[model samples]
Target chain A: MPETPTIPDSPATAPLLRLSGLEQVFDTKRGKVPAVSGVDLKVEAGKVLCLVGESGCGKTTTARAAAGLTRPTGGSVEYLGHDIHRMGAAEWQEYREAVQYIHQDPYASLNPVRTVLSSLTAGLRKHKKVKGRHEARQAAARLLEQVELTPAESYLDKYPHQLSGGQRQRVAVARALAMNPKLLIADESTSMLDVSIRVSLLNTLGGLRDDLGVGFMFITHDLAVAKYFAWDGEIAVMYLGKVVEHGPTPQVINDPQHPYTKALIAAVCEPDPRLARSKKTIPLRSAEIPSLTALPSGCTFHPRCPLAESGDCDTTPPTLAPLDERRRLACHVVARDHVAAQAGTG
Target chain B: MSEEPILSVRDLRITYQTGRNSEVVAARDVEFDLYPGQSMALVGESGCGKTTLGLGLLRLLPKLGRIPQGEIVYRRKDGTTADILKMGKEELRRFRWSEAAMVFQGAMNAFNPVQRIGAHFADTLKDHLPEGKRLSKTEIRERSEELLRMVRLEPGRVLPSFPHELSGGMKQRALIALALALNPQVLVLDEPTTALDLLTQCSIVEELHRLRAEFGFTMIFITHDLGLAAELADRVSTMYAGRIIETGTAEDIFYDPRHPYTSGLINAVLPVVGDLPQLASIPGSPPSLATLPAGCAFGPRCEYVQDRCREAVPALEPLTDRPDGLTHATACLRAEDVQHSREVVSRA
Candidate 1:
């Protein structure tokens, strides 16, 4: 057997952000929908934690909770060992400045009426990062250059509509960087971009993680993108408001333990024609995702899971538990397999 | 392999009148031969004219959009040939769902929210029925049910539902069924599996594969996704700035792309199954059609670009010819110099 992968456990410094038992329930007219349930995650400075799942799988809900955008209906969002909801005004302001959010649509995120300079320097001016218009302009130019919108003066006076999708996304990144944020929560930031532009934007974001020591809670539905952006980081696979699998990027991608992770990875259409022809798909029992309001009993993914057993999988819900020293899984079948393997080895 | 092409487009130009005297050429000088039962993928970024070309093929361009100059030679079901651009109003109306149909990009907006799913199919069949043929209500229901079942949707539950009642995948499948209601010889799908979950996309791809095998219809799908193109297309065409920059068999396009833009696009895609490869994005964005550069549209961002590329546009020249007119061609001046190896982009 291959040796277990090891992620450096830095106990010396507190994580930049942590979500402990994070839960979000929306009381719609139809019913109470549990969008995110008991999700635990950690992002240290300069590290990435990618949340990969399909739509309505609670990736966005988890991200919003982590960003302190919405007060969680249950559990707590802690930043630097302090609960975000219980922080004082000074602490809240610091937390707000420390954690920034980059929305999915660049076209809609940036104000169409505001020029690039004004948008970039709005947060800076409000937060007193720059004293005057001259200083703000200089600071904005520097921020734009940091995101690789070079010769920044040319872009300073332009509106959002004048720039291309890729260029507009760079401005969004520049606006986030203006806050000097320690952590950034980017929700499907590159999904709207073309393949070429998407890769370039990912490269720029990866650079920010390394150069500025910024932690990222990147969320996307594209597995290839998650693999590329968070290769050295961790990936948490969410399925219907719960994390089904969590591990190092390479480990989860190459040797997926959870059936959902395996199925998702198998479902991706590789760009190469040879691979496309040779790929083997994991057949699901059902194609439709269960509705959030009417969730299935026990393990939510059990209905579609090919490996799901009759009594245990249907009667009891599985908790996200440590599968190995480096990974966590929430499948009963996989957990049983791990136990059996341990018993045999011992 | 020597069979006649069902759709042969030559020097096709689609333009939109922006002002009194100004017109923007969305697609120009586009030439290709789509053989019967062939699946062709039009791959490009947004605003690259793939959609415009697809719309133009069916004469479905908006009121402002017009086919200024081109010959879209289409072979009818009875083996008669006619130019789609020159078809009379009545002829075009009859030719549209009966000869060729389109599954638009967003299935949500493609459907009417108030109408039941069955009505969409009934309307299509009733409007496109052959001359002097009357269909009973029972016949329409039977046909619509058969179409829905072919796409794996239960007609009993789905037929009575509104567009908002079905999921994105179900809606897409229903739209495909509606498009096939007339049993058109050709189908045009724009971003069929986009905006869907991974598993749903996989099922849709599989469904399309099965449906094509059973129906034996020609297909032309427009998408920005290289992965989907690799999966569904037998022939791949890469478009850049209103022109097909490269055209070839799937193997040639994926394995040995000659155009710098095509190579760059292939290299930019990240694979999920293998080791992470170094990817390099082309430097600049696609140019606006209104103020296109002097010569090659991709010249500004192409690594293999030279002074020759900026002087004049290059025509699509065939590099290798195959059976059924499946020729590997590209419009790059430095086609010979640009290597197809993945290492070229990785090294950059």
Candidate 2:
């Protein structure tokens, strides 16, 4: 039993942002729709905690809840040991300023008519990061350089339409960093960009985490990217708004205890052609993800879980339980298998 | 491999007419062959003309688009080769869905929001069925159901549902099913799985591979994600600024890319294993198609650029230096240098 927990635990050190039993439900024309449910996550300074799942898995909802873009209907989001929703106006403003957001579509997020200089410097001035226009301009140029848009003056005057997709995304990053934010909630920030440019943007983000000590709540459907960018961080695998598995990045990616987690990892096609061709069969049990409006009984993944036993899996919902200090999983079969294997050895 | 290609494109040139009588060379000097049952992935950044090339083959260019020069010689089912670019309107319509069909990018969400899934399938069948071959409503329904099942969707539940009623993955699968309804010999998939989740994309790619094997169809899979392309395609072509810069077998492209652009593309992908290295992004964006740089389009961003590379364009030529002497073509003047070297353009 390997039980080396990577994240430190002590009363003196507190997590930067923590969400406990977070839930977001929308009242649609059909009925109540649970976009997110029973989600728990903790992000410390300088450490990323990526939320990975397919579309409609509530990864975005979780990120929005954490960023205070939308208040969850249930549970609480706490930052620095204080409930974010209950903070005073000044404290709330501080929290809001400290936590910034980067959306998926950089083209849509940026102002098309305004130049990058205005957008980048406006936030800096609003946040009181600079004294005057000249200082703000210099800061904006530095921010652009930080995101690797070289010779900052060259790109400073260009509008969003004038810039390429990659350049626009870099400007978005620069704008986000203008706040000197402690936490960044990026929801599919690079999914819209081309694959080659995506890696570079992720590299810039990883650099920000290292140099500026900014924690990221990176919500994406890309498992490979999450694993690569969050190398020293953690991964939370969600299914239909539930965190099925959460653990250290390597452990979660390598030894996925949950069936859903295993399926997700297996679905990622390796870049090598021989390896991809060798795996002729898809690991998923089914092609369909059950409707979120009418979620399956018990384990939400049971309908597509290969190891799911009919009675137990369809009747009793498995709660996320500790596999070790470093890993957590929510699967009836995995729990049973683990205990069975242990009993056989003992 | 068959001596006769199912489809061959030579000297293909495509340009889009912008405002003020300006023309943008979207695809220039594009050439490749699609063998029976083989999938070719056209990988590139946006505006590299991968989509333009695919659309050109199907002869579905818009009014503003023109193919000033090219020969898209598609081998017909009856052992005849016809230049699709010169085909008449009626001939093209007759050949469109029955011969080569395209599923545009984001086509899953491009369905008619007001129509049910079955209605769309029925519409395609009605529009493209062979002349003098009429099917009853019941027959069309049966065929729609069968097509739906081929893509792993149960028609009983999906046929009557509106597009909005279906999940994103379901919609994408349904689009694939719709594309296969007419039993086309060549399917041009434009980033069909780009917006899809990994699991969904995996299953879709597997289904596509199985379908190609079962039906013996030649497929042109266009995508920006090289990893997905490597998994699905038998051969890969990396495009840059309206040109095919590199063409090789999947293994050759992934393991031993010769073009600096191709190498940069492969290395840009974050490794699933090993420590996260500094990503080597190709610096500087691609030049405008209207006013591309002289010599090589990728010269400005390439790390292995030389004086000769900037003076004249290097034609995509075979790698005669290879031990096996296979036809791994690259358009880089310093192909040997890039082959011997590795990605050194690490972005800090």
Candidate 3:
């Protein structure tokens, strides 16, 4: 059994950001809707903490709340032991400068009319951190250089349209780096991209984390990218606004404990037709995922849970428990006594 | 494997006159056969002529274009062929949906937003079914309900609801239901599930399987995601630049990909299942059709590219030989060498 990770025993030293019981409710037309509930997450000073899930799973909403783009209805988002939601004016500016967001669409997020150099140096100049135009341009060039857009001078004058998809994404990364941020929240950054280019972009991100000890909150739906993404950090898998399963990347991805996680793995396209055939396809359980507006009475996944059909699941959501020394999952089906009794090995 | 195909197209070329001085070769000598009950995927990146090929077959190519070369030979039931390109717009209209139809990429926008989904079914039936021999409005409603039910959506709720009221997946299902209303023998779907989320994508794939079983109609499903293609296609045809570079069974494409471009696509995909595998994405961009290199278009990025690959375009041919004589084909010069080459020394 894997031991629970404590703040002092963190691989990189200590947790830089500690979030617990983050509940976000929105006033929908129907009623007050909880977009995110019972979410606990943490990121160390120089580790990548990927918040991965399907769309409407509240991963993006959680990211928004982290970046201070969305207001949290409840819960605390702590960075270096400071609650960002309740930060003061000057502190908010500091958070804004340190926590940068890289949205999915690189083109739309950027100012089309503005030049790349201007976009890069604008943040530095706005914060009044740099002295003159030449100095800002120098800093911009260095930032672009870090992102591997070598010959940064050539890229500086070009508009977003003048660049390729990969180059445009690089520029977006460079612009975010210009802020000299401590953390980057990339939300579905490469989902709407060509496959060939996506690999190099992921490599570039890994380079940033290693070469520069920048903390990253890398959010994506693709689990495969996470495994070989050069991230040596833990993972958190969200489902319908809750962290259902999470732990070391290897454990969560390879030996997934939760039923939803199992479904996600089984659904992955196998290169070998034989393996794909043998693995039972997680049956198409529902045409539409149960609405977030009116979640099921007990555990959020119970309605879709195959285990629930066996009367093994109920309304009382299971607490996150350690199944092994390195991993933990929040699912009633993975309880030790239940498994031991069923297997007749205890 | 059939005596006659429902849709047989050969060397069909369609070039868009971009401006007075330049012409974009949208599709170059594309050829394929869609037999009854057989589906083929038209896979490629954006601007690779997959859409142009579909439009040319439907006689719905933009006003600035026409089929400049080749024959779009659709073998009809009466043992005759219909030259779709040569047909008049009215004749083409008469054949639309009833004989062949399209289920477009984003079904939400394709649906009439203001109108209910039921009315779309009514409009399709009225437009296609023989005027003299037709079902009543009541019968049409019953059929529309059945179509909605087939896609797993509540017929009653979906029929009365407007497009916006339905989710993207629901709207796509509704659109597919409308397409089936005509009972066409072939479906030309372009990126039907590309726009939806993964959970939704799974359901849509299920819907696609159900659709294939319910109606043994041939399909020319077009998309850029080969992962989705691996799940959906009966036979996969990979398109690059402006041509179909490879064609084979799903197993052949996934396990033993022959084309460099196809392999690159497969390698680039991140493991979608449990903990994701490291994706080894290729590091270059797809070439522009307007200014592709003289020889092999993929030569620039291919690892095993040869000297001849630079000067001569290698037409797609059958794989050299599967030891047990498996059936697969590729359009690359080094396909045989690639087939024999193992992916990696497995640690296990």
Candidate 4:
């Protein structure tokens, strides 16, 4: 599983990760905490984007500024079209081995005294991508049989407290597919498993994004697992750290044009008891989420939205744009009701 | 709703010890009832003993847990009853929080981080008074500012702050206003809106459905979220390697589940509404309550397992008999061939 490094077939034009106007901020002795502010996104190659929101909504600072792990106090992450904070150390070691990440506590991200073949062959023998210890134990048993954890020689000498939070998140997605990465981010990787091992670790990460083309960003706060692993990829949502609804995950989860993505898809909870008592929950005028050092000037969810409008969502902010021709939106009253329903059907 | 029940339980079990001459059973033969304003839920997953049967229904286990065998019974508020494993220590401390209380699964370290949320409501109203009844300090600051303004919080900026100054939905609405300070007629909770934040778990599930329609009590809870047991259950159950295979209502356990581990935890959930269906997941991994499986502790993740499901345990029973008594029940030994192959695959 290592010898496939030829990669630059180029033509499908650039996006194997981009972020743009990203911002991050921090400082915090109770001050400059803007935790991600502009956040545009893209991913392509084997699509999927997800991100969704909630807990201090920055979706882990826009996935640690798209996994160049932090550094974005303001915009730009890019990756394949350069600028991973201005690359060059061999293009920042090919954007750090084609970008990888994974983390959301597979019990505090692996390494409980290592093992699963020394954490999948220590980044394929520190990026030489295998040359010894028998081809790094056959590329760590083909990454524990590509995360299904089959008889990969009974999980190559076990450990991380002998596995099972869905086999330590399939050995943290086989240590992020031993760096053949081309984008993976993950954060909250199957939110600490067990809904029958979170649908077989999301069908082994939707079979590594359809048999290894890979690209994903994924992060989640479970909009039913970002509508089942980005149903045909794309969904954005976020909140105080901006991207209020971007589209195509079945039209941002079936027509959500943002009142905070229809109050996070009407605050979720549906495993069905007549769709959890015939759904419809919207309600928020304030269950209180503000304070990123007192946010709420323009639309940081206009003091708990429910159709906001106090002087156009309290003096401006909206900015996501495009509401149709496949989604986008950020809400000044749903872009004035999609421009008065396209001026009443033109 | 033929009245009477307010907590019943029965052939319970519990156990724990795990050493010198071992011991494990973590909840077994557990039965149930509840009735008075009932809610139920329990659902399973995480070492499914549903928090050791919600801390063995209030005798709150821990210390190598115990319970041992059966009965819980309950029913007090003067219409007497008893059992909670033969009471005593001051009748289980005045029948716990004035007759069944709980709320616990992490309201960020369930209070006492250097007290002050009005001294955890004046030390749970000065150690659950009534024996020489006392209260004072402006009748405990007007009953802890009327239980933090009945969970809408604000009590003069949360009774002089401190449990790390509020938020995680104000310490789960001040731990459901200190588990409704002694107004208990049963509450339990555990994983109450687990680690808050889907709009603070939808305003703490709409402040527990408006505090169970303005205080009607009898709740239970324990979760592993099946969409919060289909949004705050009206009876549900499920549990796995720690026994209860199924029990119903919440539309017979989410539209007729007859336990192939509650239809593989309702087709492994992921439906934030519509399309993208095919799910699967229940293939082995939930047996160990110390090497269980030899008889349906969800027999190796039963996709309708048989061979008399490893020849033994399968009791839960019922399956129908409702006229609103809410029965359903399941356990399974091919629960009528998995409800006749789920009514011939949902009638094709």
TM-score of chain A of each: 0.96, 0.94, 0.91, 0.39
Standalone chain B TM-score for every prediction: 0.97, 0.94, 0.90, 0.38
Off by over 4 Å in 1: A1-12, B343-348
State the lDDT of candidate 1 residue by residue for B284-309, as single tens digits. 88999999998899998888878989
Winner by DockQ: 1
lDDT of 4 by residue, B137-207 (tens): 99989988999898888889988989887788888888888888989889899988887778788888878
> Chain B, candidate 4: TM?
0.38
Clashes of each: 0, 0, 15, 1
True contacts kept of each: 0.80, 0.68, 0.52, 0.81
Please provide, for model 2 over B1-348, each residue's C-alpha lDDT reduced to its tens digit, 9 standing for 90 to 100. Answer: 665778888999999999877889999998877777778899999989998888888988888999999898889778889989888887888788888888878955679999999999999888887777778999999999999999889899999999998877888888988888889999999998877777778878878878888898888889888768878887899899999999888888988898988888877776554455556777777888988898998988888888888898889998844321236899987888885223322111
User: Between 1 and 3, whose lDDT is larger?
Assistant: 1
- Score every model by TM-score: 0.97, 0.94, 0.91, 0.36
Q: List the DockQ of the predictions in order.
A: 0.57, 0.47, 0.46, 0.29
Instruction: Report how large a share of the reference interface contacts model 1 reproduces.
Output: 0.80
Q: Rate the local accuracy (lDDT) of all candidates.
A: 0.91, 0.84, 0.77, 0.81
Which whole-number lDDT from 0 to 100 does residue A346 have in model 2?
92
Question: Model 3, range A21-64, lDDT digits (tens) per residue?
Answer: 77899897898778899777887767888887777888988988
Best by TM-score: 1
lDDT of each residue in A1-346, candidate 2, tens digit only:
1222344334257689988889999999989999998887899999999999988889988998899989899978988767789999999988988899998998899999989999998877776879997898899999999999989999988899998888898899899888889999998888888777787788889899999999999988888789888879999999999999999999887677887887777777666676666654436667778878899999989888888888889998888888777888899889888889989999
Residue pairs that clash (backbone atoms under 3 angstroms), model 1: none
Model 3 Cα shift for residue A193 (angstroms): 0.9
Alpha-carbon shift of residue B280 in model 2 (angstroms): 2.0
